[model samples]
Target: MGDALDIMQIAGVGAAALVTEMTRSSWDSMRDAVARFFRRGGEERAEQELRLIDTARQRLVDNPESGRGPVEERLHRALAIQLEAFLQAYPDAAEELQVLTDRIQGTNEGDSGGRTTVHHNSDSQIVIAGGAINASGGFHYRAPEGGR
Candidate 1:
């Protein structure tokens, strides 16, 4: 009877340890996913804003009179209008992206915004960010599944 009781206690302790490890891993994965979501969202907003800027620039070059005031003035106004529209569309995501783009464009944000780093622990994160905006947005990390 004594030997049987000791064996049962050992088994219980092992099971508890396994559960703890699994829980920790699961929490880590959840945190990673949230981070990836925010990073990708920011990248998407930045890309859209950039595209708008390009389009506005081309329009200013092609048809100067139709835009706004002077060529440079028109370009600035158009860029601002387009960015405002984007922010309206995706308020939460656009806020961060606008900051990033402003930094990249050497605006008054004081960001020096050319460099950005995103860390992810899975290939899926890469696919999600890249496939959407056609830009490399996230850092890859070893996932729990060990696939990538």
Candidate 2:
């Protein structure tokens, strides 16, 4: 009888330990899943911003001499401002978007003839240049504040 009681106590403790370990593992997985969810959300926002920038760039290219007197400038400024605001809302993915923006802007500026070619590589880095204005240039990313 004494040996049986000892065996039961040991089994109880082992069972308790297993339950505790299972609970801990479940919590850890939940936490990781939540973190990934937020990360993916931020990435989606960043991609949206990139698309907006690309659209704006295409518009500029299509109507370079549109006599809307400074319309292109205003549009570019608005896009930048809006994108910066978006980045401020999602700092986690801001770095990549910022790098892309800077590269595009630099390429646009260096091209004296307002005609530029853009090349996006598999690595997510883009190169832009006018017919003969191909000096080495690159972009860097910046993060926004308040987790924006």
Candidate 3:
């Protein structure tokens, strides 16, 4: 609506909200809040939008080996379009959007936020809960041809 960058920003915000909220236990409330922001056709419309959110989650879950980069990119495009259209219809929703943004950020800042970690060999990643992350010198190994 505004410009390429502006629309992308709106889309990024939407994507971030979707990413953050889908993991949270209070997902329904978060979904309802976002729906209310658009003030779309009411509760039913909001529920429909929530279905989209669920689809996004499924994409991430179903494509673990596919890497998150490509998945996130696709989501960004879809969410950006949705956000741009929604904002165009309800410019005042920016404040409501901020409310969700702050809440997610605050929630993450507490015990529920993201932490940095790198994992090897296994399918799990090491997560830092409350303290600073630590690392040592790099380690690398070459699998012996057909050996371990």
The Cα local distance difference test for each model comes to 0.42, 0.43, 0.65
- TM-score (all chains, Cα) for each model: 0.29, 0.32, 0.58
Q: How many residue pairs clash in model 2?
A: 3
Expressed as tens digits, the lDDT of each residue in 81-124 for candidate 3 is 77766666666665566667778767767754556656474533
Over 4 Å off, model 2: 1-41, 66-69, 91-148
For residues 1-148, write the lDDT of model 2, one tens digit per residue.
6644443443333222222222232434433332342354566754664456446545544563545335454564555455345434554544444343354345445544566555653335444544445446746545556544
Worst window of 10 by summed lDDT in candidate 2: 14-23
C-alpha lDDT (0 to 100) for residue 137 of candidate 3:
69
Clashes of 1: 0
TM-score of candidate 3 versus the correct structure, residues matched by position? 0.58
| Candidate number that wins on TM-score, 1 or 3 | 3
What is the TM-score ranking, best to worst? 3, 2, 1
RMSD for each model, in Å, please?
Answer: 26.1, 26.2, 9.5
How well does candidate 1 score on lDDT at residue 32? 39
